[model samples]
Target: MSHSGILTLLTDFGLSDPYVGVMKGIIAQVNRSLTVIDLTHHIPPQNIHLARFALMTAIPYFPARTVHVAVVDPGVGSDRRPVAVALGSDPNAPMGFLVGPDNGLFSGVLSQYPALEAVELTESQYWWTATPSSTFHGRDIFAPVGAHLASGVPLQKLGTTIAVDSLVMLHSLTPQRTKHTLTGCIQAVDHFGNLVTNIPASEVNGQTWYAVVKDVTVLGRKTYSDSAPGELLAFVGSHSWVEIAVNQGNAQSVLNLGIGDAVQVILNQPHSSQGD
Candidate 1:
């Protein structure tokens, strides 16, 4: 393996352990000059859907040819295939490579770059350890193959090619829409405790709507700052999705919300005002 562009790491293995460090060590052994950036290691432990969203939101910021290794495999030892994906509309020019389990972790990335090619990381020639562990493929299989890909190895050379359509899709993460309402699940709760919903901001289009989260209703605000301090409000978040938040406070703490909680955004009913 030779020197290459950025190698990113996204995992549920928090910094409290040596799992992340060991993976990087393997990458370093393969290509000492490869710059490894920690995209994030705090993925909430085996939460594949959250990992999918995080990857989707963050990948566009990196330069082309970046190799991303994301490991949030709760089914690590199972029949779930270890895989590598190359994102590109053109078969000849790959945007980048992603190495991880074949679970929904890569679904968002695949959705954005529909032309991407994928393959099961079956070839031991690309992995770090000959006898890979059942539980820790992140350190053994994913890390080294990502390093090899960063070093300019062809996608096909890694293993047998699989269609992107065949990858495990995170279909449930999408919001359900009706004539008067858009229903979605809480994809994640950020550090600030804002509930990030799968409902895109376009669905509401900044219209007057009321958000029902955890059975509590709050009128939509343009921004968190628009609402009174400690008052719960729903707004278009940074990623262009509707989020449940509290101005100057934590919604997750105040409202007892968690990931996968249901959220609904419905068109606000007009009141019969005297002027109207």
Candidate 2:
């Protein structure tokens, strides 16, 4: 908190390895005063889509001027370009910064924030040490670049500006909707066993509905304990998305639901509080 700005780290590298430590070491060496927060280090190796989703969920919670450095690159030694991105309305706006490969990891972030500005991390000399390992640029290249940016160096110094359309974006998962039914798939399962679905709350027209996951139908509730303390229920999450959870237990374990599982929301029937 002592630093002028925030620098957050997100990576597919698990915490057991020295990779996260090495990246932090490089950043600390450059700007000791900068505050560094670890958004996540266990992102399921090489899962760029998962990384993208995690970044989208975590970045908005941080204050403005937070630099987010994400490294879920599976194409480290390949032709993929190392890049830095900023998301905000104005090109000169001081907001979020993303450092990673030009893979589809930026997809979710770009979708959420349309006014995105990006640039390739082109200055090799600005990178740490004399020679950077092609495989570990997270420590050698990205960390140093992030540290410099967190220290107030202009983003234009990172590289030449580019069009937002030029950046790579993955195809987003689509939510299917009918007259009174909305179908979506489980996008992710967090450590807590909460099934995060692709369905956002905005898509639900009614206050109550039936959340059918797999073959089990859980009555939609407004809160975790809308049923009983240990009962399974559905609720609109803080992210404004519907999630199936147990009040005092793990829904993923109790119901055996995982990522990519199908979920359906059936709207309430006339004169009935719950959907059939």
Candidate 3:
């Protein structure tokens, strides 16, 4: 199917179980012709920060009016309201719908499109079942509501309007910087064992800097291949974040670093040029 009538899913429910399939089934049941895209079912099991980051990276590629349903809800069935947000007040901004729990899973996407309109998904009739299972609202609540939105249900009719300001925000854990040092924590370790940090690519600037990992000092390079095999290399990763990797090797294994481990960039001197 083409991207029209699109509904995207992002969740921590791995494909090893039937959870992802069940949600797709519910969405299909609502509108079989609607194109349902799985952004990912592997979001580190309620790691909302990672889910938020993934959304920001992926949403830009979808067509306007695509409905994105992300469910990394750790507070599922709690007071955290299910929500369907229509992104952007500006007619020129890419129009779309974001459906999920109001627990900040969409915070990264929301941050980029600041004029979005949101609503609490309180209307039971819009859900797949009136009596939703407490733990699996992804199937009962989010899937159906997102399907309906893709099926042409009015966003306002989904529930009461909410102030965009009222939506929960994930803690913005930005990197700290001083005159010579920039400090950040590893936010994720990817499948290849590259350490993704909170440090922006703008911080590194392709300049001469010391990457302080444990007791080792490696210079920041513009690409992974700039370092020799098995050497620790710091580079601006594909996600535009500073990442630590071992060329042709795994940094997570070699450096013994995981998420939340500190990675520092100590500048030797200011650079003559900046990097994108």
- Top lDDT: which candidate number? 1
Q: Which portions of model 2 miss their true places by more than 4 Å?
A: 1-4, 229-231, 254-256, 270-276
lDDT of each: 0.84, 0.81, 0.83
Query: What RMSD value applies to candidate 3?
Result: 4.2
Backbone clash pairs for candidate 1 read none
Residue 59 error for model 3, in Å? 1.7
lDDT of 1 by residue, 1-276 (tens): 322478999999999999999999999999988899998999888889889989888888888888999999999999998999888886766777889999888887777787478898888988887799998999899999998889888878899988778889886557777888888888878878888888888888847787886567777888867878988888888888788888888989987878778888887554222210
Q: Give the per-residue lDDT digits (tens) of candidate 3, residues 1-276.
A: 222599999999999999999998988888899988888888888788778888887988989889999999999978998998888676444388899998888887887786467889988898989999999999999999999888888778899988988898875566788989998888777779898888877776756676776756766788877878888778888888888888999989988888778887888764332221
Candidate 2 lDDT, 22-122, residue by residue in tens: 89988989988889999999888898877888988887898877888999999997888888887788655655888888898878878888736678888
Worst 10 residues of 3 by lDDT: 267-276
Q: Tell me the number of clashing residue pairs for each predicted model.
A: 0, 0, 0
Residue 48's lDDT in candidate 1: 91
